[model samples]
Target: MEKLQNREISGKQKVRSAEVGTDILKALAELSPATSLSNLAEHVQMPASKVHRYLQALIASGFAQQDQVTNHYSLGREALMVGLAALASMDVLKVAAVPLAELRDALNETCFLAIWANKGATVVQLQQAVRAVTLVTQVGSVLPLLSSATGLTFAAYLPEVETAELREYELQADSNHPLADTAKYQQHLQQVRQQGLHAVHGLLMPGVDALSAPVFDAYGRVAAVLTVVGPGTVFDADEAGMAAERLKQTAEAISWRMGYTRP
Candidate 1:
């Protein structure tokens, strides 16, 4: 068995390593059905030779696999097994299930749970409404900090230095993809901070809108974000605000349950 070790590195070193790893993971995940080594290297802006080493490591450790004929890299069986294991071991899901279900029933929308990761925001848990429209994305999904309502809400509630670092990462991501512009991204973060909630429409999908609010921990710090998503045809601006308010109240309730108290 390959030993997986977590090395203690400096903050700067961690940033450099995680940035590279995130880029690679994003490339592989985006490729999904089919992806060649060269294609992944170009997507992540890394040399093919260097990326080969990373791929080899991933394959040897069962995080990824190469196709027999097409020579494409896809998520390995171990990756799926690990993902399942993660779901099984997630305490947050167990803790948030009943409350999230209640929130979903109250709002009649799809509820999502996301946590902060070194790369960006990682969706750890999910509870969908029976009558609500389903999202193409699901739990274990990783979204960029700038383009996601949950990410923006988390950033809005983060400390100054942490937010600044996120701003830099967003700008860099913007430079790579024309999908998200830097100036507008800055404005979006500002809106999140000012409004105490985020209601972004047509950002994730063509006809979807999401409203999110921050969930605090016992320390009064943002621990996670709770969001509700719905189709735009059924959800209008007013509905968005109502959902945001409801999500905010639900998040606060969860925070209080976690022993968070404001001075």
Candidate 2:
């Protein structure tokens, strides 16, 4: 009888734990940006102490994080990894593979496919040139919003509020390296949006120039960035230049494959 009772208790404990975890995740998902402990506890209708305990477990498991300064809770790297794994299996990645390959082959430049995720622009795929140059980044690398061409493509397309939040986040995360003056950054983003492409010449890394264009989804949302990186001498930045035109065309092709119809 004692063994059976213990079994029942164990089952009940498992169900209760799952319920609390689900509630916590649901609350976090519904809250924008990050949620304070008090707010999150209230949202889940749980005691603050109880919520904090669960959050500690979540943090340990890489499912959530607590900002040391703000004490706000947000999803963590493991959550992002899970989402990226699912995104990788999506049809768009499969659809983009061929055109991305063609673009790299034609341009003879290193090509990257970067997707906008919770953390910002992240490189998901890369194809290196036959004679690869000294590239620093790789797949799974996060591009800085104010620096990388891939990140600028996203900054230009994402909503203003989101962009602002991201900018603040970046500033807080990298206090040492501040972004450019606001007016200058805005002007750069304006040009990127107008031209549908952005280029950086040795901004983040010496001897490397990169041109990036956005790929939109069926709903006209910027879904990904296609970036071509090569030596500064070979990667043309002029809008009418062969490399720029080819990059834009390839991005358009991928966008079309993703069901985006030009409006």
Candidate 3:
């Protein structure tokens, strides 16, 4: 029994050491490309002596480095390798699968994720709410460039060269379209960018409300679009409502996991 207790204590100590190491490494990355030891300790909320001990171990493991002259520390080559590997392995659909399900459960609305393709915003994944009898869209369904909250979000973030032809075609197809005027359309796109999300009321379907937000990748490109659909009364409140905030938070978390940091 004494031996067993000792083994348990050893295991716990090793786990704690690992947690501290990771915390120190995170602080190093947050304060990078370089930061003084004092700053790092304060950032991690650890004593300078304790942090210094961890830094010594990190430097030994090639996960961190300290300038010989200035004593400032930064993430080392091994840390870079680990970060690149993590970034490379991340997939938007896989990363967002759980969050999308959670968001659907929280809002009790049909939620779907889409990616920009030659056909425009194409639905790729979906989570259906319990009460949603009729599906709003399905996998491989290509949504309209001007009529959908998802499409407008992709348009607002994606480069003009990729969307120009479609925009022109959509405009010429409908002469009386509200967004037919170039200036007016640009203004609408600007609003989506400024607000970090786009919402539509019954444009995609009658008596339905949909809100969409963009998921960004490491390079800050729009990797996917996340959208939620419900009956018109579901989102009676404006953008500041609980549903919109939840959508924004979910999208932002997915973006962060995909390695995007807002500049």
Every model's Cα RMSD, please?
Answer: 19.6, 14.7, 2.4
lDDT of 1 by residue, 152-224 (tens): 8877787757766766767675666432565765676787767767887888777888888887765678888
Tell me the tens digit of each residue's lDDT in model 2 across 1-263: 99999999999999999899878976886785699999999999999999999999989999899899998999888877975675555566777888989998998888989998878889998888867464666899988887788988899998877678778777787665545467777887898988989888887788888999999976798988999998887667666689999999999998877767787
RMSD of 1: 19.6
Task: Point to the candidate with the largest TM-score.
Answer: 3
Q: Model 1, which residues run further than 4 Å from truth? A: 1-94, 163-170, 176-190, 237-240
Tens digits of per-residue lDDT, candidate 3, 1-263, equal: 99999999999999999999999999998888899989999999999999999999999999999899998999999999999999899999899999999999998889999998888989989998887375557889999898889989999999989999998888788878888888999999999999988888889788888899999999999999999988886554257678889999999999999999999
Q: Is candidate 1 or candidate 2 better by TM-score?
A: 2
Q: For model 1, how many clashes? A: 0
lDDT of each candidate versus the true structure: 0.75, 0.84, 0.90
Which candidate, 1 or 3, would have the higher TM-score against the true structure? 3
Q: What are the models' TM-scores?
A: 0.57, 0.61, 0.88
Error of 1 at 108 (Å): 2.6
Pairs of residues clashing in candidate 1: none
Q: What's the number of clashes in each of the models? A: 0, 0, 0
For model 2, the superposed segments whose C-alpha errors exceed 4 Å read 1-90, 132-134, 172-179
Give Cα distance to truth, residue 233, candidate 2, Å: 3.2
Ranking by TM-score: 3, 2, 1
